[model samples]
Target: MKHNNKYERPKIVKQVDGLMNKVGRPALNKPFDKIDNVPVDELISNFGSPLFVFSERTIRNRLNDAKNTFTIRYPDTVFAWSYKTNYLDAILSIMHQEGSLAEVVSEMEYEKARRLGVPGNKIIYNGPCKTRASLERALKEGALIQMDHLDEIAEVEEIAKSMDVKPSVSLRINLDAGIYPQWNRFGFNLESGMAIHAVKRIVLGGILKLTGIHCHIGTFILDPLAYKRAVEKIIAFEKELESKFNLKLTVLNMGGGFASSNTLMNQYLPGDQAAPSFAQYADAITAPLLSVQNSYSRKLILETGRAIIDDAGYLIATVIGTKRLVSGYKSIVIDAGLNLLITALWYKLQILPAQTYKGVVEDTVVYGPLCMNIDCMRDAIPLPDLQKGDKVVIKPVGAYCVTQSWQFIKLRPAVVLIGADGSVDLIRRAETLDDIISAEILPERFKS
Candidate 1:
């Protein structure tokens, strides 16, 4: 008989009633070697480790599914890509190609959309702080400015008078959607009669046209019933606007808060199981709009961001070293940190080994290379034994990671887009030392 010589680490097992021990369960040893049919090793070799990868196919498919799901029921549904979600030029270009319009929240974002060749009429300008110059520019360029407060109505009227342009605007109304922690900071409150008051003020002023009503309840909302309540309230308001002021609203903007398939830190179930599907949300939102009595045709705008782009993005990090903690638990340090993957602060992101591994499964804490103690990625996860120079893949990061990433202890890495045809293209290059200090100014007095 041949003697087996495989080495395995010794670990004490604690048995609990009605709970299967991880030691007796199958190990998560399956290798995640490829992304969109492209090998992970080849990507790291070409773009270097700690890279961001996006799948073009995944984005298109998700967007198409969302469009079809909503349009099939509403028919007048329009998708305005939320720039703040993931505003890469390539990502925006893809959205534009798919017939989506631009939804911007700041002057910089509005300018970026313009530079990308998106027409002014196609842009939906939204936010609380719209500078005087930017508001004037948006008015002149035909952007749909969604007013957030009563003061903004007067400001828009002033800008309209100066530019001699009759800008059709939208009002963002916040209401009680049966959800906790209501987002009443940005827009007028509907339940308190503030929304109706604002509408009357705008209609009576006659300087700006109130052609639309918008509402954004909250972010990452898991309950579809919240949207139903918001829509019902919006329809009631529309009825009041038409009956009292004879103002017929042509647009209904339901600002996006659809949850993405990324598990929240305190969630009881995984994201895929907890997050509501696009179909479920569509069913909840469209039912109320369809029940309205008015015969006037209205365009419904959805400003979804994370749901369409989150799962399409990925992060590949290389393991720098591994160590055993003082408590006998294992830990591994990767090249990527909180700077690159800030969403890790709220999301329990999924991490998988880039290559195959076989050994004892242990609870490991994945940490970033940053010297800060808060650079921990995964606090405790059951993972196979990982060694130095190994690679790991963190996923569903395609939404806010790239835009929110900053230069902290390490420079940001290159980002690549994998096309449907399996061709890879570099969307963003890695940061260099010169890139970081190019805008700095030094005084001659400080020079040696």
Candidate 2:
């Protein structure tokens, strides 16, 4: 039997101790050509390279799964879409359509939510910094203000007094949830008596009504038991608050820190295998709430953002060049960079070939098209020989990349949403030179 052979240029290779030879190695390349049945090539041709593609079906399904997972365990579960995670109007609209309240961390995010038709009452206003004007507007609109410090309480009280309205607010508590690097910066400290002191001050002020309690342990939390500990601490504090002030809280906001299925840079296993499922998180959270539900029913508000949106997003980039380093290692450069995919710093995002190929898999270093050395995406990844003009899909970037992305050497790319019915919509258009300098004003002398 005769087999067809392709000619190739032979290169010298360095032999490393205990390393397997590349010969006879099975090709690990698999084509990821389409997103929701929409061809990747078609998308890049219609839009451009380095495009952001989101699956509307994935977003809805993930949100629905989260809602169902918690609602079945506890009927009072409420989901608030964390705006800081990915505040793209289209994403927010989808979240709102799926019945998620807006959870904002800043005045800008709060305004964005309001502009999207989410009433002030439906907005969960959080964060360490809240301006006077925003606070006033939120109070007037009956927003759920989560007070971060005693100063915010004073500010809110003053505003409430001026408006002649007693706004029901929630206190953000920061506690030692048996996790490393405790997040005690944003909220009142629980162990240091700061939380109790803040509560006392709120009650003593008598200007604002304290109706709820909120806490966010940390982001990308892997341990379910950590949440269990947080819930236990919150429940205990709630009891103390109720007993001391004869005030029963109505809402317990276990803030968003849910881990998405994107592998952390330091993780040994992939995110999907290591991270807890929605069911596990629901059980850990609802178990404690269910135990005390008989005494007083409380609305459980979950401001989960990453877990629901991360896996739905994909970044389609084009390979521009390939090279061999001094150490005889292969390197591939793509069009997308740290400017467009900021989350690449924290996540070891999976990169897949857009077309099927038969080639030897090598440990290749993936670099972004940037002059800076820090623009490298993957330090070392096992990938087949990727040539110029080849398309690659980098994924699970639906959470923070867009929200945190900024324009640097290159303008930002366009983002499109592939709907459940295979319809494509351009949610955000690619940035142009005018878009970058539109707000800039040249000096009179310079203009002349």
Candidate 3:
């Protein structure tokens, strides 16, 4: 295919005044127009427009890179896939195949991991809302339960006493790690001495055994030095407890909030340039942990979500229509909306055209098919002229969106996985009208 570098001025320019002010043109350089050797046009043809395509090769490579980077620095390391990020069975299977443990927050997610044949010992349950029944099951099945609050400690004590079994448990501690907007709501506060008190309550009860101490200071943490601070604090706490309580906390779960290559809306530079590499983060965390002695050696656990799978997924949508606003600005609507691609609200998702075009770039407002006014993807993005049927691919959207998408306004679309051998598999089918109404039981008078 021959490239088009020639540019022609657009015909839609109308002077606002006798002396019109010139508008600045934004850059429109795209990295690539195709995905995994498949053109965006052919993907929309084989599947439908507004579809999701995942690269299994990309997922494997990223996970492998993360594991190797950490294991080389810290010998005993484990990575648990954050279930809430993207918990489709197919996605979970890929993570499990790569030897990732399941780290889930809710009861539903914990059950999903179990249903997929994941062993109980391989599951790390983290959250504040695990019911008593869920706690009972987790204890019996040997799942590592990271207690979030003091009330949960009482519930676990009752369950452990009834079963006549001493279950190994961990406490989720929240402390200052030089990170802003601390996540204190999810775990016991270490600064206020609540975490130590909770541990003493459990130890005094003698029904539960303290096995580990875990902390997830914040999310989307960009500074690797922050991890060093967190690790140092956790190790200090470990040593203090060993001296005071004479107990060993074996596992130290420095939870994950690694940033992905999706440019935040507030960011000035592109994410590929701004985000830190895995090796950098590994260095910050492992450097502090390698100083531990042989007897107190703790297994480091990570639950990285977005960084592993964001760049591996793509959302393909076609141009539904185009129009010119009254202000002479160009606007194009696509089939995808906030309902499908929620990342549009936070990150500037990169959209690339399927084919080449020859024209001067203009600032275009991208809208979704929804009737609401907030269904906008990109504002004032520079692009060439687009037709009604032009297909485009939005990229690096593989995290959080899939599991958080709602069945509102429009039905959900299908998700396909592209294998390492170039095979395309439709792992999830699109939703239908019957799916919406199947669970509804209409009253006799309401039934037509």
Candidate 4:
């Protein structure tokens, strides 16, 4: 990777009253003293290196921030927890406790939602692929099954034919948000008139009842106008559906793409640097929807995954080694790898030395303890001096990191939830060798 030679990190000075340093970036006040008292050191010593910690306060605050934004503007709003974002039971349960319904895409997610005590009626099932059994089961359970394609529609129709009751359905619409190469695979095309055709088929098909129209333009959207435009186009189609077919739309699901605070490496500033907060997203989505006039008022449903969880999660790792390159620059390697925190490989995350920021900054690279050359955390980071055995904290990773982690060459790390009272408890135990090999059995003659 080529480093940006023109880039310069500002010299930061802390103020007693406020958080900004000379760099204007919000400096993180070291919480190690408070954190250390919680037995994190004991847990790490017992559980080993590379730990994942979640703050219950952050999760509740972020969720309330997102929920309050929409509730202030729109009368009828429902926030569905996007299960694929971070599906840890503790995380999902926290969201559920905060009144979020489940937004699932697959059978596993649907079952997970069921396990979490979310009634089937509260679950919104979306995705391109669905098995016949899955569709039948979702139908039987009265979950909101979103139609992805004609084949899925046929599958649902076949099951509905044998069942005693008809199924409730929603059609996923693909809109040209005037951005991207266009997403045509997951949903029916709105501009090409395919979506209208599908709606008519579902209305006339007799096996399924169309309850809503759903649209998801894109993911990690930086511009608020993109959502405004998408909402306008979506409402226009809702109008056409109502006028043309006399259908009363019950819900309009503008699917999740709200960008999290983790900035992409290619981005000029970090995602938290200029990325819109949860309130901004809520406003961008609901404003256009509320402006539209409808015969039957529609409930605005949001399947937000990343923005809800990203700020609440933190990955804590210990510095395992330090090295000086042939070019005489310092580098730090940690025990955590891309196998556990995939976002670190893509997002140039802001790394802070937990207890030690000695005001000395250097251009550095952070690497993970992986054999692959590609398993790097940050290529060229201007960070404070770090020593081996010192702790480092990477923030705003409460979103897709845990859900997307891979077990490539290492076991995943344990996840601990820090409560409001400052007590810590293990939510997920770190993987064990027996846990890994329990599913496998060797024949006596073929044992290695």
Model 3 Cα lDDT, one tens digit per residue, 24-123: 2243455356789877777777878789999999999999999999998887999999999899999999999999999988889989999999999999
Scored against the true structure, residue 9 in model 1 reaches a CA lDDT of 70
Q: Write the per-residue lDDT of candidate 2 for residues 316-425, one digit (tens) a residue.
A: 99999999986678999999989988888888888888998765667789999999999989988777789999999999899889998888899999999998999999
The alpha-carbon root-mean-square deviation between model 3 and the true structure, to one decimal in Å, is 6.6
Candidates in order have lDDT scores of 0.91, 0.90, 0.86, 0.81
Model 1 residue runs over 4 Å out of place are: 1-29
- The prediction achieving the highest lDDT against the true structure is 1
Lowest summed-lDDT stretch of 10 residues in model 4? 11-20
Residue 287 of candidate 4: its Cα lDDT? 79
Error of 3 at 442 (Å): 0.7
lDDT of 3: 0.86
Residue-wise C-alpha lDDT for candidate 1, range 1-448, written one tens digit per residue: 9988998777563322234654344335478889999999999999998999999999999999999999998999999999999999999999999999999999999999999999999999999999989998899899999999988899999989887877899999999999889898988999898998998899888899889989989999999989998898888888888899998899999999999999999997778889999999999999998887652388999999999999999999999999888677789999998999999999988888889887666678999989999999999877778999999889889988999999997899999999999999999999999999999998999989
Score candidate 3 by TM-score against the native: 0.93
TM-score head-to-head 1 vs 3, winner: 1
